[model samples]
Target: MNFKEQLTRFPILETVAKAAAELGVEAYIIGGFVRDLILSRASKDIDVVSVGNGIELAERVAARLGPDVFVSIYKNFGTAQIRQCDLEIEFVGARKESYRTDSRKPAVEDGTLSDDQNRRDFTINAMGISLNKDTFGELVDPFEGVRDLKRKIIRTPLEPEITFSDDPLRMMRAIRFASQLNFDIEPDTFDAIIKMKERIGIVSAERISDELNKIILSPTPSYGFKLLYHAGILAIMFPEMIELLGVETIDGKGHKDNFYHTLQVLDNVAQHTDDLWLRWAAILHDIAKPATKKFDKKVGWSFHNHEEVGARMVPVIFRRMKLPLNEKMRFVKKLVRLHLRPIVLSKEEITDSAMRRLLVEAGEDIEALMKLCRADITSKNPDKVKRFLHNFDLVEQKLKDLEERDKLRNFQPVITGEIIMETFGLKPAKEVGIIKEIVREAILEGIIPNEYEPAFAYMVHEGEKLGLSVQSTGTTFE
Candidate 1:
């Protein structure tokens, strides 16, 4: 297929062709841009490979396109970059690579286009379109990448073992691409990843997490997790998650496999929202099940307080995975702790008081929490799913009504310890805390409106009962 029409989107392609012809250099649009174009997917980043110094070609192209075009050159890596409008174009010299056993960094040497294509990670990315005067938009497919694209397969241009061994991160990339594109990994390539799973250790945590995030953001993340688990890469990289697999039975009672259940929840949430932290909440919602597993004669299996336990485990897991320990981590922790709250409300009589507490605790994350609770319904019985969903709607309605009336989302008590201290003419002490707790409980329990007058009256009564009287004249409750 002719990609000449696609190149018309950027007028600079003509300038690049003219410049390459003048300099006697061969240039082509390669890698992801080519692959995405063939698949009819939209892409903003374009990569170019040239037979001569990529920096020189980029400089000439930049000169032809005038001063507004910016060209950045990295001499050591034999690469250059150009930014124009909304497009970022990266230029690299045609080169071959050979890797040492212990490191992923490749020994680079200048070579022909064929050598460059041979070094690519996958067949889909190895396809290129020439920009020389003789063949301005002819595609070069040394590995029959077009056929592979038609068949929807992810296979390396070179030997699978050698390709993956040279850069173990490609193994993850292969699976990530399969998940993203809904393609299948060829049997030999899949086995190669399994055999070379140990080599993934050489990859940096940041790089691995980057790819994992992409997989998590895919339409169905369970595909990527299954591939990772089957290839043994998940065990090496994320042993904590791998441990969630399997069911241990005692006296003919066993808990469900939390690992598979987590994946199912993840996929279900992915279908609803693309928020990364919410997806993470799904992954970790039941993380403590294995740790808190117990069995009783009457109860088949129980994971008591898994939410609290899982909340405590979030920081350790984030640290191990090299994820940020900022508000994002805290958000996921909060969701894990409160994941079961909505479910409990669904089972019992939905109450405004319980919904108010949930809203206050969840704050802005209440909707995300509800989404997770809905996804957690993984029952095989259709009636059970329907009943839970119907109850969940009622619970959501109660939450909305309570929030509208009480304004309790992220609400703090109107009464403060400072007011208590001033009214009782005392320093910080247990009496002040007791008064504050009583007022807060009174407001939450609907015994008193959240207005200041009622809270102040209740505070005074509690303080008087504790043998303290108002001493400051100006400190009347506002």
Candidate 2:
């Protein structure tokens, strides 16, 4: 079918056609842009394949567009990219590639459009649309990409084994596409992935993490992760997560499969937010359960202090995965550590002190932590879920009331060690730290108000007990 009508939306394609014609070369809009267009998915990135010099075509197109338009060229790779308006169009010479066994990087030489299509990672992405004046909107489907698109299947253009072995990252891409588009991986292609899963070790950690992050960000992330698990890729890529799988029974009592439970929580969180790090928190919330798992005749099974252990594991996992180690990792770690706190509050009595502590610790992330806790309730029994949700609602309301009344979100003690030193005319010492801790705990424990006056009064009283006399007093602690 001709996409002439749809192609009208992107007037940029016309400019490309003009540029290609002036250069006396053939060009086609190929890869993801074509695939997404067929699926009616919005895409701002376009890939244009030229049978001749792509860099020259990009320069010509940039010149025709305007002086303001600039082409960024990577001469070593024979590719050029232009950012025009809200769209990014990359130009590359159509090429067939041969890879060394050790690297995914290919030895490239210019080839026909057919050769380029043959080298695409998946069939749907192999389809191309002509950009020449003679066949401007004609579809090129040598691999029946349109049929694969209709069938909602992910399949390689060449032999699956050959495609994956040439660049094993394509195996992850296959699962990523299936997760993003809600498509099925064809049986042969999936089998090829399992057989060649070990090849993923050669892929860079950053590259694998990029694909894993995309999978985590998909509408339903668990689908992609399950595929990775069954394909044995997850074991190779992230063994910590694989350790969370399976159930063990003792005396006919068993715990829930923490692996599947984590996936359910992941899916549940996906329904509420698109935050990648938060979803990662879900993935790791119970990651330490396997390590902490133990059984007693009375309690059946318990994963004691799993959250704390899991929190410690987050940085190691992030470091190994090549994920960012900044506040993003801290955020995920914080959530993993505190995930059980809200649930524990929901189950038991919701106290002002508990709310205060939770609010103070979670600070700006209380809402995100709450989202994770709600998602963590993955019981199959409808009644248990309903009851827990009711309790969570009560706990949530209590948090709102306490936060509004106490103003404890991002709370810090009004009294500082400097203030304590100045009041007692003392140097920096263990006494100053001790007095500061007293005032801070008093505020969180609700023994005194968080206001400066009450905290100061309490601090002076506590100082007197520490065998220190107050030399001066101020109404303002700051």
Candidate 3:
């Protein structure tokens, strides 16, 4: 197949062709760039495969591009990359690979373009468009990649087992591509994933988590997760999530399958926002249910304090998954802990103090927390869903109203520990912390406005109760 018009759209390909011709080597725009071009997906990354040294080709292309352009070379891997404005083009030599039993890293040797395409993980990604002057847009697809693309299938060019076994990370990539493009894996290929599920243990946690995050960010992320679950990959990669799979029944009552519920919540959050951490919160909001589940004759089943337990589990899970344990981790943890607070408020009489406390605790993340909570409503009963949604609207309105009256979104205590220490002429002690907490609580409870004067006055009174004499007046403390 020729895509001359499409190839013409990227004038940089002409420079690549010129560079390859000067080096007297066959070069083609291959892999993801070719796949996305056929699918009409906008892509900024281009992979160029050369029959000779890829670094030389990159150098020539860079020189042709201009003096300002820089080509980054990795001689050990026989690859080079050039950044041109918004576009990133990578150059690599066509090579045949032989993988060891223990490692995914391949023994590389320069070969023909056919050898390169044969090693591709998926058919759609194996297609390449020649960059020669005579065959400018000719696709070299021995594996019928275009047909697979038309059929919307993910199939390895080589044997599925061999492909996945050679680089087990390709198993995750297969599922990721299927999820990202909403394509189906070929039956044989999917089965191969199931058969090779254990091999994924060889892949690093960072690589696994990277693919998992991509799956989470997909339009319908639950599809990818369901694939992982069905293939048994989730069992090995994320046992915590897999533990949410089945429902336990006692007597005539049973709880919902939390695994599917989590997927539903994740899908709902995906519709509202693309924040990966928010979606992560949805996945983990009920993660500790299994640990905290208790059976009672009257209540059937209850997961008491699962939210707090799940919040504590967040750091451990993130560390295990090789995800960053920074502010993002804290964000997920906070959401998990407070996820039930708004739902509880909606079921009960909404209070100003409750709203204030939620606002104060959630801070800038209150809106995100609300989105996650809204997504957590996954009941099958339409009436129940409708009633909960209505209550949520009411709760949101109250939050908005209260937030306007008292700007508590970024609420912090006006009285600092330093001020407390100054007021009592005390060093860093429990008395100072106690006074600060009292003032903070008073403001949050609306007993005193979050201001310097009233907070200072309350701190002074609290100091007296704690048997700490106020050595200085309000001015001195202020």
Candidate 4:
């Protein structure tokens, strides 16, 4: 049961022990570092807890480690952090915390190591390894965190209700940990989460979004979403997503549950790529289905233009959740807008012109869009899924061939409005626009090569048809 051998791997732990012994303080490596060490997960953030002044201990440790080690101290929080050898070691005094009902912030007071462990959110993180000379590397696991680690269950170190209620953000952390480790939430702990779901409102949106991102990055994000939904957190924090839940039947016809469909798409996308924004695209691809839904005797149920509608919703969601509204937001929006195009193309015949427009619009994101489309094919019928995938293969091959032949992506027709204006002796008029559109369409439809010569010739012809004769010859615009 001695992890002293394992502790020797990090020389900094020894330096910390030496420093704490000099200061007559009890020091332990606690929280995530300990949990990950036992689980064999790679972790660089080390949480160090000492029963005496943490900042002073860290300063002494930094001095003992040598001049190269720099310690940053936050006096208000009674914490110190040292960045050494590509690792971040955070130091804090052993303490207990009591919180007000309106806030997650705790009134902290110095306490024993046991009190500190009791204040931890989950059992796995409650385990600590002493870093004192007397007991260097002896584990202090009062909550049997080793058993929970072996069981692969996430449970509170204390009563779940009190643990999560003290810091509602812990509920989000619990779900995130379950998703990341592919572990189960203990029934009582989960029930406690359901009982205290409303407490999450006191937590900040940014914190919730951080946990949500971790969940989305998990191997099976659907697990986190399902837990959030069933436990009522999603309804409180993400009502829009919750609205995607249920199917309404009219005249005995019900549409597929868009909520589960979204989760299936999310899982499928997760299997293909670890890109967080792409996973978000899958989450939001049909987000507007509920809003755009209609029932018709002819079509049973329809969610027409959900992609476009959903794309518009992305910015609002991002703004609300405090997610970046930069190009990342645009990427997710673009994917959502184009998610159905490839699917529709697969269902119908794939055409060069359709592929050209898609290539031009999707530009650099065409591949990501196609990946999302394939993941969106979540048919319960295996044969139907296979057929759609095969059709998608054809569409993909066609795209590759088109891109290889024409280099149509990010392509503008060689004929430009400025050239049309100079050649046809016109200002920026309807004739110029007509000529440009005609040549652009001709190149896309393969009526002419994407080269300058044919496009210029076609532009002249279109201009002549518009009752304008070429007054001067001009070079094609770049």
lDDT of model 3 at position 180 = 96
Q: After superposition, how far is residue 183 of candidate 2 from its true place, in Å?
A: 1.1
lDDT of 1 by residue, 201-225 (tens): 9999989988999999999999999
- Candidate 2 lDDT over 1-478, as tens digits, reads 8998899999888999999999999999999999999999999999999999999999999999999998899999899999987999999999989999899999998899999999999999999999999898999999999999999999999999999999999999999999999999999999999999999989999999999999999999999999999999999999999998999999999999999999999999999999999999999999999889999998899999999999999999999999999999999999999999999999898778888999999999999999999999988799999999999999999999999998999798888888898899999999999999889889989999988888998999999999999988854555
Tens-place lDDT digits, model 4, residues 380-477 = 89999999999999999999999998897788777777888888889878777877888888888889998877778888888888789888888535
| Top-lDDT candidate index | 2
Q: What TM-score does candidate 4 reach?
A: 0.95
Ranking by lDDT: 2, 3, 4, 1
lDDT value, candidate 3, whole model: 0.93
Candidate 4: C-alpha lDDT: 0.91
Q: TM-score of every model?
A: 0.96, 0.99, 0.98, 0.95
lDDT of 3 at 325: 97
Off by over 4 Å in 3: none
Total residue pair clashes for candidate 4: 0
2 or 4, which is superior by lDDT?
A: 2
The local lDDT score (0 to 100) that residue 45 gets in candidate 3 is 100
Candidate 4 clashing pairs? Answer: none
Better of 1 and 4 by TM-score: 1
- Residue pairs of candidate 1 with colliding backbone atoms: none
Residue 420 displacement (Å), model 2: 0.6
Q: After superposition, how far is residue 203 of candidate 4 from its true place, in Å?
A: 1.2
